[model samples]
Target: MTFQGSLPADRAQSYEEQRASPRFALLLRAAKLVGAEGEYLCIVRDVSETGVRLRLFHSLAAERRLALESAAGERLGIEKVWENGGEAGFRFDVSIDVQRFIAEAGPYPKRPIRVGVEDVARITVSGETTVARLRDLSRQGAGIDIDRHLAIGQHLRIEADALPEFEATVCWRRHPSYGLVFRQLMSLEELAVRAFRMQPGRLR
Candidate 1:
């Protein structure tokens, strides 16, 4: 059968294309399986049963096998789907355990919060730091505009007065702007309260 510009809705299968799924907040680490490449810590904005988008401060090899480790230090195997200078995507070897994640993110704000990039501070994987404005903030994660294009799995520290400094990874980059998945999200309620109150907004 010939396909048109978009696939037929009824004909669509249960499984969606890897690139089409929405992103989420994920916490994981990457360890190089071969060569002298060192292990890189990473994070995800969101993930699917099959794949994930990650951020690495250091360079990662394409077509190389990597060990994806959980916050508890559990490990899994994954293959690089794509990689640019400082960001990449990988397909997980097996479906991940979805229950481990708990929602600590606040509800979306009614209006876009206008904050400078410097309001949300960032610490590089190498310990370098900068103050950035928060373009957007959510209970799960926040988007900050920074000059660096962090690698998909690289680890770094983030700090804001509203919330304690925490670690996270780069999920993707749109040039000077990039997505961050909070590496350490302990309580969604706390995150939500802080994010909402920081700007002018009511709790949802």
Candidate 2:
């Protein structure tokens, strides 16, 4: 279940001896660890094809199996293998293309570069579809205004013009405003180019 600190001395030595892949240091990209307790923001410290190391703000007792959503739009099932203070390491359920992900550079941070937009988007949850007003957009997620109450962590699909229809999970909510993290994050450069190409009249 939960790892409080570094691996035991004997195990640490064994772990070091068994390494098969080289790990690449990360650049403080944002990520999320979803466990039974809830979702917690984390910074990726390094990555390899088979595993990742993360820097967490606080300690959490998470289940052995958890979902890691990276800013680069990677959703990985990971098992905690080691921990030390604010740092932890996890092995992926399936090996990934480490170089491909590392090159993408993840999504943009929330708020700072979000483009204000007025677009009608459809939110589908459990076969029910509701129209929501897209208030602002970012590569990682979108802020939408909707009348219906949505529970945090509810899985849904969003469809809108100028944006690819994608699956997302409700991450934050405040009355009519809800923030959804996309299951597949768009490239920051792609989003910026699209926003810039939109005609002035198209912006709401």
Candidate 3:
């Protein structure tokens, strides 16, 4: 079934009433929305204690239940309200503190958003290259798993079919797994789309 281009007038009125609390406009804040099937990248156009407006790049599942995860990895429960023309509205499962959410006040310091992936990649170092699997990706870095251990601080090149070749340095290692910080950062949109592509059973 297809979604209506707009929400029914009665529902629209209901949403308006739900926004009785103070509203906060986040304006193009990138985030991930997780559903039963998988996750999709979305932008937080604005938010309030009760509801939020999100901008979507693709169609979302029909499930009313979902979660919105921030760039800092904080997750909030949301119920789908309305979806139309690549955008959707949701109401937080419970009223949230607008100030704390906007400020990203959480248990840990805010960090860049990262997505988990498992695509094959090649890591080149010291004139030798070997196959690796992409463990996770962020705008500034990626996690990889390889069989061999390499010294930290070594500059290397990462090649993959789905991503541009990246120049990075080994930042951390744990036997077969390694963390690499990229020399160049990806734009939020690029990171979002690329992340979607790397996920299993990604939305068509």
Candidate 4:
């Protein structure tokens, strides 16, 4: 389904942690919970040095280890404790500075969260159709690989099996990869679900 509407999420919190130092509650802070299966979209509900509570957008995939990454590209190793409804709790490998986590302190400056994907897509420009390799995607833009030469600011429509047809404009190009910004932005929920579907052999 092509999603042009946003989906509402319900709160599901029943996480219990014995050791309590201090808990920081974030307001709709977006982060990525990555596993071997795929990168999952998550919102950090609250956090402490020992553990965190995340609101997941899609079904959780089991993994021995998982990492939570912020928009500024800070990755911290984590272990999943429990999951229920639309929320999950995780324990950190080591104690993290609660202030740093809430502030998103990292090497890189904070930006939009982009999910990586490996897939072949079709591109249509001026009635000409071509193939492209999808690298990564965000709500606003995407990194794509296309052999054909394309000028910056050129418009086209891109189609993929896992996503709706998106009218995009070429933003930049570097050898095998080209950056594209979508004309119609997709919702975060849609992006999460579509990215989940894009992966192969992902078990719930």
Candidate 5:
């Protein structure tokens, strides 16, 4: 149930300093760990070709291997290399194109560009379907207003006219408003086009 990799005396320091490939800080990027018990949502703090650092909301039981799925549709086979508190480090079976992934997640902006929306969407979670309102849209994810409450790590399938059906995970929630990080990130150009078509008068 413990990580096999060596740990530093002070784990608080950035581990990227010792890594080969430079890691990029991810914004609004989410990943899921498909473990033996079930899938768990995690925030992808940083990612490089060889591995990634994930922040899990809850403690994970010991597992030898797991699959990690990025918000950009990239899936990697991962083995737990290290762990400290809620954070864990993983080693990938194959190296990933970190630069390409950063580009697809959108420009390295302080905040992602968000477009206001009032579109109706259908969300399917745990075999249940519900109608939700799209409050805003961005390349990484969408803000949804639904009547039902969802667990922070729960996965859902979103379907809307302006958007293709995509997989998503609940990153955060407040009352009726929930923040979701998409399983596949849409390009900036694609988001802009959708915004123009959906809200011609109000493009923000």
Candidate 6:
């Protein structure tokens, strides 16, 4: 679904750590979820280090217990953190260190090629307007183009293809353009878009 609405600049928390590149299995199960009103069958949609984004048969009350089982058939603990109409987001009772797992995935495979990002992103701040483009992107940060006139500490929001709407602050500016770190880093799914474009058929 395309979102064409104005959102608060600080609506969401920023991504702090470097993006993880590990691929892990996720499962959707038909099981009853427990809450003040008792239980309802909910579908689990895999797991990740930070949390689980799943589809539920019935809407769950905020802060309820939804059973999660790992791919190893071990039940994992989870708590409901967000509900968007029907789909829910949960944070795991246990956080997995995905960075260690990725490092252990053998020597990092050489990236076939660097993904080129020439698309322009429109940015709006405090009713003021500016434009930026995807110059280069790594899992850690993305280079953008903006006027040097924009204050370095000013916060900016970006809209672009294949990226969740995120907020960033001016970190470095050079004349007609500047680079801003993804205040919230891209997710594995988002990273995959660039990775796959560089190395075809590597995903699956």
Superposition error at 195 for model 4 (Å): 1.0
Question: Which residues of candidate 1, in runs, are more than 4 Å off?
Answer: 1-118, 200-204
Clashing pairs in 4: none
Model 6 segments more than 4 A misplaced: 1-115, 194-204
Cα displacement (Å) at residue 20, model 6 = 31
Off by over 4 Å in 5: 1-109, 200-204
- Per-residue lDDT of 113-201 in model 3, one digit per residue for the tens? 77777688999988899999998888899999999787799899997877899999999998788999999999877877777777765
Q: For residues 148-184, write the lDDT of model 2, one tens digit per residue.
A: 9999999999988677788999999997999989888
- The CA lDDT of each predicted structure is 0.53, 0.72, 0.82, 0.80, 0.72, 0.51
TM-score of each: 0.38, 0.48, 0.85, 0.87, 0.45, 0.37
Best model number under TM-score: 4
Question: What digit string (tens of lDDT, one per residue) describes model 6 on residues 1-204?
Answer: 111243344422411211132335445333233333332334455445866566654444344675553222234566665577667766656676654422323233433112335556677788676666666554445567666367777787766654556687777777566666667765433553543332222222
Q: Encode model 5's per-residue lDDT on 172-199: one tens digit a residue.
A: 9996999999989987557755644444
| Predicted structure with the largest lDDT when compared to the true one | 3
Which candidate, 2 or 6, has the higher TM-score? Answer: 2
Report RMSD (Å) for each prediction in the order shown: 16.9, 14.2, 3.1, 7.7, 15.2, 18.1
Question: In model 2, what is the error at residue 174, expressed in angstroms?
Answer: 13
lDDT of 2 at 77: 92
Error of 1 at 43 (Å): 27
State the lDDT at 110 in candidate 2: 31
Q: Relative to the unseen true structure, what is the C-alpha lDDT of residue 142 in candidate 5, on a scale of 0 to 100?
A: 92
- For model 2, state the Cα shift of residue 140 in Å: 12
